[model samples]
Target: MRVKLIESRKVYDGEVSMRLERFSINGRTVDKEIVEHRPSVGIIAVEDDRIFLVSQYRRAADRALLEIPAGKIEEGETPVAAAKREMDEEIGYSGTLKPFLKWYLAPGYDTELMHLFVAKNLHRIPSRREMDDDEDIAVKKVRLDAAVKKCFSGEITDAKTIAAILAYRLKPI
Candidate 1:
């Protein structure tokens, strides 16, 4: 089981997508194409027993989504730094953070990995939410139980949201 690169080259360089294809194999030969994405961060911002979420329209999904605060780690930025920045920009808060789990968003075809964090002992700050000029984002707060319920209700359709809440529920205090 190994990726044998027969041929590979960068396909595109854009704000959201950078794709590549490699000729590969497990037991047989196959051409595998993967998108090389910037690493991202997901924050489960906690204050007492509540979690922060952002609701916005997703052009890809064509519906409003309730998701954990998240963004890509820019060049030369650590995942923790990106998470802190996203938490403040999206929720207007910064806090002492507890490192949590990390996971790949979609391993089948993408190279996007996400670092998950729990931020607590919080304080308010002015938000600099310059979400893509086309974005329509609204911030909200919810109890962890309610947020988990929203996941079951499919009101929270984002992967990072579900992963963060489930990890919080499973971790021992």
Candidate 2:
């Protein structure tokens, strides 16, 4: 299947922009509201048997969510660099990072590709970066086994976190 963009116009612009797009697929013209978002990184930071996570209030979710440390890749930044930076800012830790998986957050309308990473051999940063002004995050450390149970019991509702924990459990790096 081939999809060709017919036209795109900026509909909203902010931290994340939105574009009204027309596409041609197999001779049919369809319209979609595409969210123009930068690629992001999520880290499954592990030390011993615990996984570092963040709990923060998400405007879209309307509640505090427990999620793996994650953030958007800054302009001119590599995914690995973003992962490290996010870990430092959100969890005050750093480690050896290995690529685990990469996938679109929501392909139907969003252009945000998420780079998942497994971070091990963790060390606390003496001078970790400050969290973003708009962010109020609290760090949470959970046992790996219990975290996996949360993923199964729906306590961990964040998609990226669920995928990372389950994937790591299924195939540890």
Instruction: Say which candidate scores most in TM-score.
Output: 2
Per-model TM-score versus the true fold = 0.91, 0.95
Q: Model 1: runs farther than 4 Å from truth?
A: 127-129
Tens-place lDDT digits, model 1, residues 1-173: 67676777767778766556656577666766688888998888887888889998888998988998888999999988888788777888898877788799999988889888888888998657566565677889899899989889988888878878988878823
Candidate number of the best lDDT: 2
**Which residue runs does candidate 2 get wrong by more than 4 Å?**
none
- Per-residue lDDT tens digits for candidate 2, residues 91-112, read 9988999999999989999999
Clash tally, candidates in order? 0, 0
Error of 2 at 111 (Å): 0.2
